[model samples]
Target: METLRHIVLFVHLIGFAVLFGAWAVQAFGGKREFTRLMSIGMSIAAVAGLVLAAPWGLPDGAEMNYAKIGTKLVILLVIGALLGIGTARQKRGEKIAPAVFWLVGILTATNAGIAAIW
Candidate 1:
């Protein structure tokens, strides 16, 4: 069980990497649209995080931090939704503002910040 938890944690980190890379490519490479990978990776990370909090991974007497977990979950949901919508809009031949992409990056970074510091 412990080993499985670690594996999930690793996958969670990989998801983060994919998201980060996606943003980097757009921000630096001058792309105006998000790839499907960005939304997919964000989802993978969010799900893995929840999996990490499964009861089997906790100490025998430890209680999960529901507040923090809930906050992160909500933030991730927003990120995923925003990216998904943005991608869809772009696919329809509509131009999405660069600021929207930047906002996604900001929200994602905020999620990372909260996760690391909280």
Candidate 2:
């Protein structure tokens, strides 16, 4: 069970990397468009993160950090919303606001920081 948890954790990190990596590339490349890779990465991260939030593999009497988990979950949802809104706007022939595009990257990094620091 512990090994399984580790595996899931690895996948969760991979997902984070994918999402952030895609965002970084686009941001640095001067493109504001959303890609399928970003959505794929977010989906992977969200699913793996949800799995990690469970208590299945925890040691006896050890509890999960609900507050941290909740915070990260909310951030993930916000990122998802941003992605959806930005993609929709792109599809509608409207330019995605720079703030919206930048927020996605900022939030993604913030989520990773929280996971690491807290």
Listed in order, each prediction's TM-score against the native is 0.90, 0.96
Q: Write the per-residue lDDT of candidate 2 for residues 4-117, one digit (tens) a residue.
A: 999999999999999999999999985767888999999999999999998899878888999999999999999999999999998899988999999999999999999999
Q: What is candidate 2's TM-score against the reference?
A: 0.96
How does residue 4 of candidate 2 score in lDDT?
98
TM-score of 1: 0.90
- Report each candidate's C-alpha RMSD, comma-separated, in the order given: 1.4, 0.9
lDDT of 1 by residue, 1-118 (tens): 7688889989998888899788878788866588878877897898899887677766578887788888888888888878878888988988777778888888888888887898
- Among these predictions, the greatest TM-score belongs to 2
Clashing pairs in 2: none
